[model samples]
Target: MSIELGVLVAIAGLVISYLAYQLTHIKEVKTDSQENAEVKAELGYIRRGVDDIKIDLRANEKQISQMGERITRVEESTKQAHRRIDQLKGGDQ
Candidate 1:
């Protein structure tokens, strides 16, 4: 009977240990899940911010190109005016 009693106690101890391990594991998993959700939310916000920046960059690039074209036109107009002035002065000579 003592041997049987010892065996029962050992079994109960093992079961209790297993239950404790399971409880700790469950708590860790739940914490990890919550953290994962928060990370995903933050990542989504970052993604949207990056996308907005990209759009702004594209708009800036378009404005720069338009400015470059206007500058080119101004330069061409100046060159034409200089040539006309030179022709007029040569004719007077």
Candidate 2:
């Protein structure tokens, strides 16, 4: 009878150990899932920021091109004015 009691106690200890292992595993899985979700949210925010920066860069490029064209037109007008002034001075001579 003592041997039977010892065997039963051993079986109960094994069952308790298995339950504890399962609970620990479940907790670890839940923690990992939460962390992954947070990481995904942060990545989405970063992607949106990058897209905004790209739009701003495109607008700046367009402005720079417009400025360059305006400068070119001004330079051409200055050359034409200089030629006109030279012709007027020669006619007076």
Candidate 3:
């Protein structure tokens, strides 16, 4: 009867140990899920920052195009002025 009692105690200890291990494993899974959520949130912020940069870059490109057009118009006006000046000089001669 003593030997049988000892065997029962040993079996109960093993079952308790297994349950404890399973509980710890569940806690680790929860922690991993939290870490995954944090990583996903960080990625979302980075995506938004990249999108903002793209918008700013497009705006700068448009402004540069407008400046180029203004410069072209100024050059055309200068050329016309020079031609008028040359005509006046020819009449005086």
Who wins the TM-score comparison?
A: 2
Q: Model 3: how far is 17 from its true place, Å?
A: 1.9
Which runs in model 3 stand beyond 4 Å of their true positions?
A: 90-93
Q: What is the TM-score of each candidate against the true structure?
A: 0.85, 0.86, 0.83
- For model 3, name the residue pairs that clash: none
Candidate 2 per-residue lDDT, tens place, 64-91, comes to 9999999999999999999999999999
Q: lDDT (CA) for every model shown?
A: 1.00, 1.00, 1.00
Can you give the lDDT of residue 49 in candidate 3? 100
Residue-level lDDT of model 3, residues 11-91, one tens digit each, is 999999999999999999999999999999999999999999999999999999999999999999999999999999999
Q: How many backbone overlaps does candidate 1 show?
A: 0
RMSD of each: 1.6, 1.6, 1.7
- Model 1 Cα shift for residue 90 (angstroms): 2.8
lDDT of each residue in 5-71, candidate 1, tens digit only: 9999999999999999999999999999999999999999999999999999999999999999999
Write down the TM-score for model 3: 0.83
